[model samples]
Target chain A: MNLMMLLEMAADGFGDRVALGPSDGGLTYRDLYDSAGAASVRFRADGGSHVAMADLSSAALPVSLFGAAWAGLPFVPLNYRLTDDELAALASRISPAIIIVDPDSPDRLTGIDGIGLLSRRSLMDLVDGADPPEPEWDMTGEGTAIELFTSGTTGEPKAAVLRHRHLVSYVLGSVEFMGAHEDEAALVSVPPYHVAGIAAILSNVYAGRRVVQLPTFDAHDWVTLVRAESVTSAMVVPTMLTRIVEVLDAEGPDGPGLQTLRSLSYGGGRMPSPTIQRALELLPTTAFVNAYGLTETSSTVALLGPDEHREAMASADPVVRARLGSAGRPLPTIQVTIRDDIGDEVAVGQPGEIWVRGEQVSGEYRGSAPRLTADGWFPTHDGGWMDADGFLHVTGRIDDVIVKGGQNVSPGEIEEVLVCHPAVADAAAIGLPDRQWGERIIAAVVLHPGASASSDELRDAVRDRLRSNRTPDHVEFVGSLPYNDTGKLLRRVLRSDLAHLGDGSTG
Target chain B: MPSLKPGSRFTSSVCTTQVIVVKGAGEVDLRCGGAPMLAAGAAADGGLPAEGASGGTLMGKRYVDQDETVEVLCTKPGDGSLGIGDALLDLKEAKPLPASD
Candidate 1:
């Protein structure tokens, strides 16, 4: 079924229960369904398949999305943060009909050829005016629900098709694995235009939970929402979490605060342990999650639960904890395997490329080549391994692996090791050019508040905690690590930054 | 905290704000209709909240995270009693994090 089915079912039982987390005003299920009905009527008569929206996390986006779904059309949510050039490129590629925008974001779209433009304010008025006819339907297969375009860090962004069935499977896995309850309130800070944010939105909605969302993520507003709403759950990234912890550290444990909060799901990138630990200390009652997956995978392939943190810390084996750095075990319905470079299955403990085949995983991209192997597994492009206990650990991007002096070092591995340090708030390791070792290990790190140490002290600290090979050869302090819109670390950016230095730039 | 000077423009009410480097009174005021927006206008008139404003300070509840506190501009009139558009904070200073295991 389409997103329409969800509204239909929700309306019968959960109507007026607050279909979406609050924004502009409380949009009831009746409002949502009726608006979708309006959008559907408009879509069929107008024949607009490509509906592009500029707002990231507004109720307008979702309403239009459901509107498209009811009409059995494809929904493309444009990244409001993208530059005009990027939006222009996407416009050339998709050529959408309805471009819903708002006061917060209005790009140069008035002159664009052959397109219908509606600001969020006017669009709502239109949806209200259109009297919906009977649900005369001609929707497509559940093959692709949202035609998500990749962030295009490595190259140009391409549409990654996510099917409706795939999304339903994903929702099931999240609700089951997360153990979220109905009364639980979720606060979403990540932009809904991204998968992590969408996951946060849909997962909470699917569970029929209350949600409190911030228009955007600001470390300040996030903590305040948690207190005012007593928001028990949230989904955010490491950088934001670090700042929240900093605020909490300066403030006491009991202030304008949360009461019913239970979790803060961390995704969009690997959770730096230092950041997670600091968050644990700050919002102690909130369970922390390290969720891992790609856009093609419908959001979550595996998750490192809060209960496993102790195990991660207690494990003396670097390889074991490195595995702990993994994205997580496949969800209940998923199967994860390690494949050799040639796509052959590797032994359980060996570090091979990670592959996944399951319901939640996409079979193929409509406009692109298939990402699966001959045997039906999706090549995650992530270097990781499946353990004896079936947990999945992610090392780094296979393409991101650095070859230095005949040693294979994934930046994720190096960063994971360094991030465990108490003083280190966040870290990124890269293979820098070296006359001696061809490419030497170099790390750029950020320190936690009220804590500071020299680069040499940090090097020694890692040496004390890890093997000589794994220890960073050089250390330098950085203000912050660069990140894409989705919160994924731009390792290549770090590599380039590291390249722009003298041999003695190591601090 | 020391670096933050007053005069940051606020849209809706915020819970806390730090590093508000507007350097003038004209920071973008976050609003939902008349109040601040929670998500994309979710909580509206309910984004951060009216309580975040205090003494017209922008760094208090309106711009901060939960349980955490900050100083803000009082939304009240300086002449005497609390006035219209006066900033009100949920609390004056930082709050502790949730106690952990």
Candidate 2:
């Protein structure tokens, strides 16, 4: 039940296969296994209760992750993008930890108490110098494997705890052991702090797929690397996909010549319809997958797979075609239910909070009680509805649902209609205080270059598709929308930025 | 009888067979090589496998009983077959899910 078992199996099954870096000169499964074993000895000697990483994606990430598991310590990856004060606050909470950092910036957490700093290069050197110990990782399966800090847009960040059993179940339920072909390679551009990044490493390794790390994301670099490495698959956030679509479009009709990429999965935010549509048109050979999950869930709980994507795009029926925006069906290993505010199950095609129960669902956070109900369902706070055909459509966060004159308005519904317009490039709908109605809807619009659409035209677009109550009261044309690094829209930031548009009264 | 629970490991006394329980509970006659398997790392009494159960087991494959109540994943290969009492376990077919990270 230890994370080391996966590495041990990989080492035994495919010792000679490349597991990381380039195809010819990368570390093999055996090498990674030995390095993890050696790193565990160093972690144990350091007397740290936890192992933390403050750097980007690299060989050090997998080493530290497995090494901590081998040493029976929790692994925590801190957001390197946080300011010094914010980083210090988080570091203090996980004090008495060994933090891995970039060699160039070793002093990132200089003043933190009881924190041991080890450069990535030095850690690698330790791996190269020391001989690994015999296989002896704890096998209870109850030990914490990872502690991810949620991107707290509303308030302070909370550390989401993932135990070994939860993660191992996720990998086993979703992936087959040694299923990937020897030539398969996956390009990972997400940072180490994200849950997707962690999942990508574990799943790819178990499936025996070679990994190529991209420390920071850039669309042009991503396209070039895919070609150079002959990468067969990739996972990206919505923001990254949008930029890549732009890059591919700029290369003309044939696209960026990415014949090697067979599958491309996008998630971590609400992908604008126009972006996904253009992407499908440009990359005709690639299989598009829309994965949906939260940090609380180990990773993806549901996915809209390749065949469904092509079917949704080609179908003429609006009901089937609209599945292009749906999250598809839940995983066979998980159970999903849409429950109302009173804890009652909603009818099919009805909107409610998404509650899920599964072996991979670890709805526990540090210092907080488990969020699971008596029956074991974890209420996700995400607003969504399941269609009669079983496709799940996610509206934004439940907290962002706008209540206007006793009617509930989903910003995602309005934004979807607005983004369909040819002139609109990106759009976000937010609710502002209004004296007349309980709240007034405001649409923040980003238009394509040199393209223009009047507020009346945009409002009519929503009014035509949906009920008149869903139309925006006002439209604010802006240069761009605010999104976090992981592609989640900063609605709270938007609400505050556009606060002046509403009356000062709380009504 | 050996107790079986998910995540418990077992090894055969006659051959190199090793398995981790994926789905099974309570005590049962979990046998390999026509002999009762012992907990992992337990001493084995030297003897050859029985004539009927010497087919062999493959590494990384899952074996399940006829009623599909018990499932065990082979972590190590062996010269002996795995079974519950008289009925031999069949290799479980892979479901082949789409790759999603």
Which predicted model would earn the best DockQ? Answer: 2
Off by over 4 Å in 2: A254-256, B43-55, B66-69
RMSD of each predicted structure: 19.3, 1.6
DockQ of all models, two decimals each: 0.01, 0.60
Per-residue lDDT tens digits for candidate 2, residues A1-507, read 777878888898898999999999898989999999999999999998899999999999999999998889999999999998898889999989999998988888997889999999999998974678988876667899999999888688999999988898888788888989999999999898999999999999889999999999999999999999999999999999989988888898854578999999988888888899988987789999999988789999999999999999999999899999999889888899999999899999999999999989999999999899887899999999999988999987999999999899999989988988999999999999999898999999999999998999999999999999999999999899888787789999999999998887798
CAPRI quality of model 2: medium
Q: Where does candidate 2 chain A have its weakest 10-residue lDDT segment?
A: A248-257
lDDT at residue A55 of model 2 (Cα atoms): 94
* DockQ, candidate no. 1: 0.01
Model 2, range B8-94, lDDT digits (tens) per residue?
A: 889998898898887789998999999999999998765878888999998878899998899988888898899999788998886
Candidate 1's C-alpha runs over 4 A off are: A22-25, A129-131, A136-140, A172-182, A310-326, A434-436, A448-452, A502-507, B1-101
Report how large a share of the reference interface contacts model 2 reproduces. 0.40
